[model samples]
Target: MSSSNSQKEILTLIRDVSTEKSQGERRVVNLKRQIEELQSELESVNAELEDAKRLKECTEQDLKGCEVELAMNESSIQTLEGRIALLQGEVSTIGSDLEALKVSEDICFVAGGFRFMCMLIKCLCFEIAWTCWFINLCEHAFRMKNGLCDDFIGKMFDLNAMIRKFHQSVDSASYEAFSSKAVLQNVHTENAHTKQVEEGKKDLERELAQIISDTEKMEHEFLLEQNLHKQVRSSP
Candidate 1:
């Protein structure tokens, strides 16, 4: 009866051993699936990071182009201002010449009078031409200033907004990468811990299997001894 009870216990142990092995296998499979998911997330985050970098580079290029254009516009404004100054000087010189001719007319001899009349006519013509030229210069200066002002204002606004956008994008991309990296690190740490636990469980299972094998061998020896005793008693 004790032998039968011992046999029953051994069978129960075997069933428990099998169940533990299956559970271990299932745990390993679950861990592997988790690792795969984490890896996929990491790859997706990296791709997004690369795309953000490319966009930032493009924005930088655009800003550089805008700066060059602004420089050119400033140069044009300077040139126009210089031309306006020169036109003002020419108008002043014409006014001085006209004043001298008036003085000459008052001091007249007949030849001097004739020469003075011709000079006056010439001055009048020059004044008309100078007035037209001065008006044109003023118009051109106004146009150049207005155009440059508008262009500078518009370009500056665009550049500033773009720069801010680029910075925001860079910041956002960095933040995303940092967050992903942190998650990856956490997943890796969990995997490492899980692997260690799995290794420990395997060791424990191996030891348990050895113990069960030894117990089975001992149980077989006990059964053999019991059968021999029974045979001896029956033969007597």
Candidate 2:
């Protein structure tokens, strides 16, 4: 009986050992599966971290570029401001010159008009003289054929020479008138050019102001991005 009891106890021990070994095997397999899942998750997390690091580098590069652009804009804005000041000085100078030109133009206009009027009167006198000479010559020819007097021909030639001299004097006066008109036109052209230059300068100043505003805004955004990158880097 005792032998039988001992054999039964041994058998019970063997069965318990077998069950415990089976449970241990199952637990080990479950732990291995958990480890594989964890490993896969770790690999996924590492890939995401690498991508984030690359993104951070790109963002930093963009911030650096923004700073460079901001610096350049500041320099350009300063240059444009100086240029605007120069243009303003030029505009003031041109205004004074324009006033002087206006006075000169007015004076020249009256003188040119008088000279042209005199020239016209001289031309009329020449025309009248020519007509008289032609009529006198025709009459002299007829008188010669009819055997009459021809004493008026010499006098008519002398009168025509006097008219030619008067015409030449008037032509010389008209040259002065033409020169005055050309000078007045040149002054007007210069005034117009100066005004145009002033307008262009104003446009450039406005454009530079806009660029400055945009560059400052971009700089602000760059600072914000830098801060965000710092926060992200320190988060973990």
TM-score between candidate 1 and the true structure: 0.38
Over 107-188, each residue of candidate 2 has an lDDT whose tens digit, in order, gives 4455566657778986888788788868877776776754344455666678768877887888777876667666655665
| Lowest summed lDDT window (length 10), candidate 2 | 192-201
In model 2, the Cα lDDT at residue 155 comes to 65
Q: Per-residue lDDT tens digits of candidate 1, residues 10-48?
A: 999999999999999999999999999999999999999
Cand. 2 Cα-lDDT? 0.68
Specify the highest-TM-score model's number: 2
Model 1 lDDT-worst window of ten: 105-114
Error of 1 at 99 (Å): 4.6
Error of 2 at 51 (Å): 2.0
Q: Against the unseen true structure, what C-alpha lDDT does each candidate score?
A: 0.59, 0.68
